[model samples]
Target: MPFRRRQLLALGALGAFAMQAQAAEPAAFPSKPVTFVVQQSPGSTGDLVARALGDALSRRWGVGVVVENKPGANGMLATSQVARAKPDGYTLLVSGSTPLAFNPHLYPNVPYDLRKDFSYIAPIQDAPFVLLASPRSKLTSYGQFVAAAQARPGELTYGSGGVGNSTHLVMEMVVEASKTTLRHIPFNGVGPAMLSTMTGDTDLMVSVLPSALGQIAGGKVVALAVSGKARVAQLPNVPSFEELGIQGPPTPGSLVLIGPARMPQPLVERINADVRVVQQEEALQAKFREFQTQIFSGPPSAGAGRFLREYEEWGAFIKARGIQAN
Candidate 1:
């Protein structure tokens, strides 16, 4: 062959090799260990879910899936770390709606933008919140709670995990929907906030059902109303906010799986499909019920859209209510 002919054949061979490599990428994903950067500390709900997911994925892929707990800064630290990671599916983030949906609007200087910095892979679990009242407050029903709040206006106080927490914002939604005024008392954590409600330091408070189930079972606080559209089995007598004629925020307690932005579409689909399989397992289903959470199903883009919708919904509520993080 002549010099030009040889050169053309070499280029064509190289191009074909490159295309083969590109095509094999998704199938060859997790040739090594994968990491899940959990936004909450060990033993936290987020951490627990991440570990369970990691285990399931490890079993499915025949490769180790590691869970790294980077708890602090209201999930910003872990989230930002994942955001800066390479877009390969190896490094991922496990977090709740508070970080992806509520944090950017609450904190003025959030380092990462949900829309720009992450590829939403899937939602793992949905944990709904419950609105509880102290016995001293003499509130037993959602209707009475709303009536009392309206009657007392800003005098009735509600406690939350912190200023910009989902617990806080859910109450703000309740306030806005019921057209009532209630003072907010922010605490360092949900434990303290729930304790305050039990002690009558605050007349009412919001808690995720898993954390609140023990207290509700013990009758430490009155379960007035729950979040989500339907009543939960644990609190059978309590009505959901929807049943009480008020709409709560959408998917407020969903635990989501996400990766760095610009990940290849095939890899994302692979992860999403694997997650759907893992979530349907009987063992995982038992764990979900134990945690008082349910599966949130959808494609990868579903989580992305949910974050945007929630950000807009709670952004307005936070600004109007003058809520700020501590």
Candidate 2:
């Protein structure tokens, strides 16, 4: 053979050897600690779920899992941070429906686009909101609440976690459906909003089942109706908005896991599978029930589709009612 031909043959052999060597290397998906960024305060529902999941995942992967709380801007702060993080599957986000579904329609300029900036990992859980009235108020049932609102338009005050949040939007739906006007008082978080209602600062407020569970049990607030398709087991006596002939979104909020966009397909599948496995455990399911949330196990695409539907549905509602964040 000619000198150049021999040189080419030798290079081809070396290339084959390199490829074989690379193929022989072991797979190392999670060789380091993983971080889960939660979009709520330490004691919030989102934080609790994230910590539980992190604990389970850490045990499964035999690595440390850290949960970081970045609570502000209606969850925009934590969402933006995760959206911009490296898509190596190390950084993830555990958040509720506000940032993913409602924020885009509520704000003029959101920091990140849900479809473009993040990958939907899997849905964790979903829960309904209960319309609670101050015990001091005479609004014991849904009918009385509406009648009072209609009788005194803009006189009844309702508090929410914040402007453009699930608490705010769900109450807006109730007000529109009943054709009554109520003053809105947006608080910093659900805890404060629940407190305001219990203290009679606000006449009524819509709160997540878990957040309001204790208050309802303690008789601090009276649950007039729930914003769900059917009555929640925790509040069996409380009627649902649907039963009261109120048409609106099915649930008040949903929680989902997400990661930065452009994650490797293998990594996405692995994480999604692991999440499903984690949610299937009996212990975790019972824990989720304690939070008044149902465990969600579905294809990764389900989360994305739900987000899109909610965005459009809420956008139409907000536009029709001219609801703006305060």
Candidate 3:
């Protein structure tokens, strides 16, 4: 009994030593440059938005901020990278509605359990959808787009970024609500779909504003309507789908930041605070608007909670639409 007690005491001492060693490790949380991984190609609206915010953070925090582009894999490549990253603050993600909200519904076997694998840092911004048609086409407004489509019945084609994307679902919901029919053209990306519209490869692309802005300004494509509650500031004259008497999905996509789950609450709070400050910088906001997007810096820890509700709602919506995850 005496020998057993000594052995037990030694084991307890070793455990204590290990705990203390871990706790004593210098908390130089971002002692080095931090990497912000994004699931978008260069020049993409999401990528540009991330760079703007990253520059601001670099200036304010005095620590180097690097933006890495990790496109493709349906954002799964970057999402998985951020999900499996250490809970430390060094690695982060400029997550969009793709990985944060829609992926849960679109992927049959999501690798990272959102609720369990992520710590939502802060809501970055909203990317509203715009329903646009080719300029050479006769369609002038949402009503015209719908009426022309109904007249031809599946003869009109609408382009999408890809399957399970916000643009795809937006068109689906709009067609279902307007009681009209149109052919669906799934493209590799928004750029390709928009190009198809410009070349008359497709009738229109229910894409985000950034994807269609240049062509709209060039008169190559027509500005149909914004798919939101209010008019976009960039195109003040444009009306919303609601104004066109068409109601579908509201607030199609947004950009947000999140880290791996089990992140220390203190570290999460530090990152959230710094990021919120960066999101509100006047210069950053200006650049964001240049892309026709808005920044969202909500309460400190509210992002995670918001994501939880958003995930549940988006999942239900996808299921209701009978959209398969594949």
Best by TM-score: 2
lDDT of each: 0.84, 0.85, 0.79
In candidate 2, which residue ranges exceed 4 Å CA deviation? 1-26
lDDT of 3: 0.79
lDDT of 1 at 107: 81
lDDT by residue (100-204, candidate 2, tens digit) is 788888788988998899988888887778889999887899999888999989999999989988888898888888999999999998889999999998999
TM-scores, each model vs. reference: 0.90, 0.92, 0.87
* Structure candidate 2, residue pairs in collision: none
RMSD of each: 2.5, 2.9, 4.5
**Model 3 clash pairs?**
none
Compute the lDDT of residue 323 as modeled in candidate 2.
76
Higher-ranked by lDDT: 2 or 3 = 2
Model 1 agreement with the true structure over 1-326: per-residue lDDT tens digits: 99999999999999999888786558878799999999766776777778888998899999999999986777788999999999899999987878877888778899998888888999787788888999889998888988888888799999988877788888888888889999889887677898999999999988888888878888889998888789888888998888887764574887788999899888899899999998889888888777777778789877777778888887777777777777
